[model samples]
Target: MQMLPLNMAAVTTVAMWKAIALIGLAVAEAFVVVSSSPRERSVSTQLASEYGASARTRTRDDYIDINRESGGPIVRYDGPTIRPLSNVRAPSLDEIWESTMPVIVQGGSLRTWSFANPQVDAVQVLFKSEGRPIDADIDLWNGPDNTPHKMRVYVEDGARRTFSAIIGTPRGPNSIAVRNIGQLEFPLDAVVRPDMQDGLAASIASVVSKAEVIQGGSVRTWSFNPVVQSVAVIIKTDGRPLNSRIELLMGPNNSKQVVEIYTEDGVERPFFAIVETPEAVGSVIRIKNTAPLEFPVYASVAPYTLGEYNFVGDSNSFNEWHML
Candidate 1:
């Protein structure tokens, strides 16, 4: 090999290029370390926590959990979730108003009553007996046309039977006829009312009212007045047990803050709850059933009043009614 003279300038330029490449690699590594640091991680974790909290507040049974093995957050949802009734359309007050009267029927003859208002769409007949089992048959006929629009037969033993029937088209005048076909005389109560649509809408709009018989697997919601201090909910089931849940929404944003579970064993029971501080302008209550079969369910709400009570030495206590 022949020896050649070395160029110092060229050697210095190569050293400079190597130094620049090493500096670039160091800068890239530093950038990755800063991105994965505790401060950055904490920011992302906080954002996730806030999102989870907001989502859980809107639903009845949704939450976040941490995985034990992996130490990672997991979201879980157990449903039949309750929702607000703010957007539900309700009936007018006049539609639900009932002009109820007492009716008595004897023998196997039919008795009819002509509507004083002339313009009506529906009729409700409620029959009750105290002695033996009785059967009642009811029919509704529209005036002028004398068209038999609706009819029903009810057979029950010392129990109340209510039949609500509708007339297809509006009429100038209408008549409702009821008869006791059983061996016993029946004492009954009758209500001449408007269509059910108006009544149902009115009930949902009012703060303290009764709801119609709700079928299984259906959900209903009611709104409360702002001045209400507390509310009492009464539920009645027809024949089978009812598995239901109630959710209460509070605050302006209507967050699901309170929850109640109800199991009705073919009986009437009342459930009550109190309002929290900084009372909500309005609150919403939702009822949902998890059963597969359809059953008759009625719910009503009323304001709670506090009164004085005197406790005697015995197990019984005397309660006095007084305005709070």
Candidate 2:
């Protein structure tokens, strides 16, 4: 065979092509390795990083033991851990204003109770039936403002029907009246408690980062940064009240706490829950509204240093309060 002189330009082009191919191959391999890593495989881990959750582990001392007793019914601590206002105390039914009224089928009867103290902020209504399901239409009135506050038309079956409403402002006196709308007659029990704004305000560590508007029949997730001890979500509709389902998920295992809020034709209401301890991976809050109307929502996460506290009086006391 006869040898021919080499073309340097052609040789250089081939060499460059070879180098580019090798570089591309290396980059593809790196991408595959990163995508298949254990950390990247976890959706929660990725979400935590995206939300700026701290990876550092928290010490036991960082948390306050609200329920120190070791071996009874394990009640997890949720809410703000901080000390409440000086005047704030656990809600009590003993010192509340309560009254009972007979249910009238035709023109619903009304029972009004006067509050000597003007600090009452919550009202609870319980319906007692005589061996049958009772249906009633209850209306709450703020006597000082002379305006109708909350109204509920519900059926009380075997279980005792208890309804609670939060009063936004302090009033001189209020009255709740129930009318029998169903066939069965029942007695209505109403109780009122003072507002918990002072205690709840003292527990809030920071305002919500942002508010998200979600359409009806849709679900949205809110991730917290620097995981909080507790979270309170305020859901507001334009003019009608709707039912909402909330889920709180924490840790790598994604432990869940669920809360459901059902309201009538009202302006706004709040739903609150808390985690026993802070999670390094942060927490995920999911809200689902099944109503036909869209609404606006915002969540306030309680500070880790102190959990929020509301009056947890008798089993029937309305404890949760709006953040003022």
| TM-score winner | 2
Please report, in order, the local distance difference test score of every candidate based on alpha carbons. 0.45, 0.45
1-324, model 2: which lDDT tens digit per residue? 966557977898899999999999999999999988876344457777655543356654454323345432113334334432224353322123233343323324554544445565443443433334544554455554554443333433322223333433334455655555454245444433334554332222233344566666778876653224434454555556656666656555353444455554335334322222233234676777766655543334432232333322232212332222
Question: What is the RMSD of candidate 2?
Answer: 17.3
Off by over 4 Å in 2: 1-119, 122-193, 201-206, 225-227, 251-255, 265-281, 294-324
Per-candidate TM equals 0.30, 0.36
| Residue lDDT tens for model 1, 202-294 | 332344455566677878776654333334454546646655555555545354333333333434222222222113234566666655656
lDDT of 1 at 111: 80
Candidate 2: lDDT of 292? 66
TM-score of 1: 0.30
Clashing pairs in 1: 90-201, 91-201, 91-202
Could you tell me how far off, in angstroms, the CA of residue 301 lies in candidate 1 after the best superposition? 22
Backbone clash total, candidate 2: 8
